[model samples]
Target: MLKQNLSPDLTPLRHAHRLATLYSYEILDTQRESVFDDITRMASTICRTPIASITLIDAERQWFKSEIGLGKSQTPISASICAHVVLENDVLVIADTSADRRFGGNPLYTGDPDLKFYAGAPITTADGVTLGTMCVLDTVSRSLTQEQIDMLRMLARQVMMHLELRRMLRLSEKTSDYRARMLASAAHDLRQPLFVASLSVQSLLQEAAPHQLKRLTLANGGLETIKKGFNRMLIAASGHASFTLAELDDTDLGDVLEFIHANFLPLAERKDIRLSVLRTRLHVHSDAVQLETLIGNLVANAVKYTEAGGRVVVGCRRHADHVALHIIDTGIGMASESVNTLFEAFRQGDAQSEGLGLGLWIAKRTAEALGVSVQIHSVPGRGTHFILSLPLKASTEPSSEPIVQVR
Candidate 1:
């Protein structure tokens, strides 16, 4: 009597193509589903086998997508019987493992569950790539009838259809999420500034004096409020327009601090609060425009919350490979619980304060785009400090470095 060879040769190129097709489905390592479980259960019952599995051939293993009567989730590809079925791209049936020299020595045939009979139909894609097998296993030697074999192939096709459906559902979910985020960003950004402008107008109507000149002075404050609100709206719009890394560059930390001082000094003065900058000669890797917006928001927030005669200080602390730009203020600080939610858009620490609570949120988003880290420390009734740690940019020219305090 002559022995028959049943193992199919799996070439490297063919295996690579099969793996690529499997990955495109993105179904590997996903949680168990009743759909797949039902299919495997049906396969076991229809074939009169003790075990059935929908096995996927991964890079280094054969992972069971669904299994009945199997405790393990996966097995090594080297020891996998389905690995051979996938290579054949057709149904493989072994009536008796002990009689087949190819599987008689396989551990699965000799070990627990002691599989002596096996049949598998390859789960093939429409493009003809065989990703894995839908198979039945039995502890005793047996042969499947022609009808049973045909049924197994049909079940394999059903498995492929389910995988395709799952892929389509995942893509649809992602598209919906993207659209929702876009709508939320646009609505929030536009509404924030308009809300602030309305508040400013209301304040002007109530605070204006009888004398023309005094009314003009009162109107100046309201106009400033409108201007600041528009600035915030513009920044938010730009952030959402098309966020990318192309806006990044080597920016001077000192120059940004100076700009903040120039812009916010009058607002600080009108409130009878002290504002100062402790300048440094540090240059950091960041987007200059976005970095300025981030620092400006922090400073403005500090000024808004601080009481008359309180102080807001902007400075830098040097580190070995990075520098931390600190905005410290003597203000009505926040509770520890509130600190966590400070960066959430439209969340205000003090509902009584004027403006939409997007300042810190915008700052946080800008810092992320620049790959910088922002940290906060606050004590109720004492102060709040925002620290932005930035990577130090390399420079060719070395110059005198000094920390100069300016009021």
Candidate 2:
């Protein structure tokens, strides 16, 4: 009879437990054959047995996973001695099966070549669940030396290792598939806003008045925002490609702030907010592109969270051996908790906003790469102040320049 009815009280759980273990491997019918077959072949040759198999015990049969010298594919559990070895959950040795009580009356011993010798070791997982067995059989009543039995068990451990590798490979493929889908979805959602903004700007420029030109300028700002967001996503995807820093140049902080104010003033005006550049002509030696992106991200963040009619002030001060630039804004500033984890990649502490949560992280990393220091102080209800300190050129003396709002 097929051994389908698992006993509720004692040995019955073994059938169900083995079935569960077999399913967990996720390796049935997989075509990428590994070196697991070599173990079975080696085991057969070393033991000098004509038949050997790596059998996975199922609910009603013994599945021949990796077989050597076996013409039959699988065997019914009722006729499989390997199935009995799995049920016992230990190494089973019947030196002379024909002389034993359990095998003397069995058909596999009494009818088929009069089977007389058996040695099987349980293939158990790390958690002590016996999945199946690696066994050798012969028709003559014979005994295997102790060393042969130990080597057979070692080969069983190799089968367990093969199953574990297949499980990890499947998991890694799944994670990579999920990330690809996420990037594809994010690209689709962001394209709509960019297309609308570009279309609006094209229509406005045809018969634009001076005041409407300002409106067009503000609308064009959305295109830049979308582009910056996409660039940040690309940077994340191209993970940690190192950038080579060139020698710093003599760059004026005032010129950089003036350029930003000129570019963003119309956008701020459209929302009834005011933007001011309070200092000009403060010079330093640094990478201009890095400085531009770092400042742009900070200013963009300020504009995004601030309410209409609020003010954003950009200024710089001449410190002893460095120049300090500040961007202060009356915006919906972050809480203490958000500030604590602000520089961590993909970790957005504020749940109410929609973003990739990579701006501040990229900004901080860029600043560190350029040997600049950035600090922030904020309260949830009040506002935020971001301070950037850049080292000064040692040989050049400070130039006297007026503090004015320049276009």
**Candidate 1 per-residue lDDT over residues 212-269, each given as its tens digit:** 5476566657665764654454334323243334556678888888898899999999
lDDT of each: 0.74, 0.67
Query: What are the RMSDs of all candidates, in order?
Result: 21.5, 23.4
What TM-score should be assigned to candidate 2? 0.43
Best of the candidates, TM-score = 1
In model 1, which runs have C-alpha deviations exceeding 4 angstroms? 1-242, 396-407
The pairs that clash in candidate 2 are 7-12
- Model 2 spans > 4 angstroms off: 1-241, 347-352, 399-407
What would the TM-score be for candidate 1 when compared with the true structure? 0.43
